[model samples]
Target: MKLARAIHFDESDMRVYASPARTGEWCISGGFEFSNWTEGDLTGKPRQAFANGWLGLETFGRATFVAVTALEPAELEALTDLLAEHFVTYYGAPSAEAARPVAQEEIGQMVELCEDHAPNTLLTVARELTESGVREAYRVIESSDAGLDQFAIHGSLDDEPHHH
Candidate 1:
């Protein structure tokens, strides 16, 4: 299977995000973090995160970019468990048992997004609060041999140091 991992090009993510995700952590849209937001809340590092950051499953932090990568079933299961616990601890979910399916669905949404893209393809998300609710759009940047070097955040997807 495939999913996305956070990639950092510089310290911008660290500086701008109140809690920036560590490079190489698994990420998801994490728009759930902003479900209660209002136009008034759109003002600072939180605003920057709501604008485009991907949420890291490990740190519950924000990331500006993510790269598609292979995933093992065991790793996916582990992530699912971690996310479920997060919902209980942070969002007041009744229990990890009750939250597991929702957590899986969130990760599943990301899985579907990456499923169509090739490994190492970069992805970014943009969101805005609309009249009805939050709106999100994704941009995909497919990797190319000529330009891949530009994204030094990722050395080679096949390289061990970048995986994790």
Candidate 2:
């Protein structure tokens, strides 16, 4: 399967990349940059500039990763809808009740694997959680004690001396 990532940096720029995880594996997907606009500036009703567009394209078979500086309540809802669309597109259909168990199981397996080997790479852990068919699994792991420990260990490793 072809994996794509759309990262929204702040409220100004949107970086869309395809297969950014691997080296020398570039794809035709390019990034989309957005201009910054205040609540009142967008539609004159206090709305996000990219909310509609982002939510509209969420139903396709694309994996989007949003990284915003600040997220509001309305924006959260929009993001949730986008995630739901992503799940439905990637999996089969939209059924949170049915997807929850599978998502949880995938997250559990990711936790176990990270604890066993790559305990010093939280980003790797997060990526693994995402790739394991569990959308937003990082949020669950981030809220767990084990996940916090793993993050600390990963941080410590980053601060350690490099022998290579």
Candidate 3:
């Protein structure tokens, strides 16, 4: 399988590319490195929303992705509203709750718990936690392909986790 990569700087900027996959579709994937967590830097941008310690949407195909950072509750609420708008626009009204930014600390605890498990296993656990609006808000967008699936979430990893 071929993978396409894209990076967004801050909240206002976004860039996407098509990969060698047969569908020629753009996939969304990203990770948060929360070495620096500050309120001013995160809330300065109009489109930016901080959850734990990272900024920007970790999205794919203009649909599903994660937003992890250390944002205030008000900021997270605003970001969730924005994500809902996007979800309605792209995915035809989310059957699930709209995406919301999650705190970096919550993500840290989850990762620590999964330290001994495989990466995919950890992802499954995290997905379960974010499903149906317990606390962390996440949306899973279905891909065009019949056999392939993509996932996105918002959180910070002390280090960049390798993607297989």
Candidate 4:
């Protein structure tokens, strides 16, 4: 998905950081960046546009990991896994193997996997994005879900992160 070069953040204090858009992991960039954000938080409906069934993740402070993104619960979950898999893919098998493999068949295990991998995935994404350049980083992180691109943050989503 494509986005305006100038990313709009709801929070006045939010900042932008750069990270490279690498191959094999590019598919997970959108979600990974949003999930691994350090300087900001996430806000939902009635506040930042989640009322439309789309969630937003915004950046905060003078240094930001991700600016903002609006996505569905399903897409969030899917992207969570994608980020995890990307973690495993980039970091090799040892670390990922230690984090518990994603059990695709069992809903319960899947939930657990998401819980377990979120932190690691975020860290991994953050590390990679550190040198990717804000413009390219934000550009790639516009949307993870196909057909659901182009979202705006009318308010701050970088103060607190939440789960739907």
Task: Identify the leading candidate in terms of lDDT.
Answer: 1
Sort by lDDT, best first: what order?
1, 2, 3, 4
Residue 108, model 1, lDDT? 96
Q: How do the residues 34-125 of candidate 1 rate in per-residue lDDT, one tens digit apiece?
A: 88899999998999999999999999999998989888999999999999999999999999999999999999999999999888888999
Candidate 2 residue-wise lDDT at 109: 41
Is candidate 1 or 4 superior in lDDT? 1
Cα lDDT, model 1, residue 67: 89
Return the lDDT, model 1, position 161: 32
Clashing residue pairs, candidate 2? none
Write down the lDDT that model 2 would get: 0.29
lDDT of 3 by residue, 82-128 (tens): 54554456545653253333232333343333344322221111111
Give the Cα error of residue 104 in candidate 4, in Å. 14
Give lDDT per model, in order: 0.89, 0.29, 0.28, 0.28
Off by over 4 Å in 1: 149-164
The parts of candidate 3 lying over 4 Å away from their true place are: 1-55, 58-69, 94-164
Clashes of 1: 0
TM-score of every candidate relative to the true structure? 0.90, 0.27, 0.24, 0.25
| Best of the two (2, 3) by lDDT | 2
Candidate with more favorable, higher TM-score: 1 or 2: 1
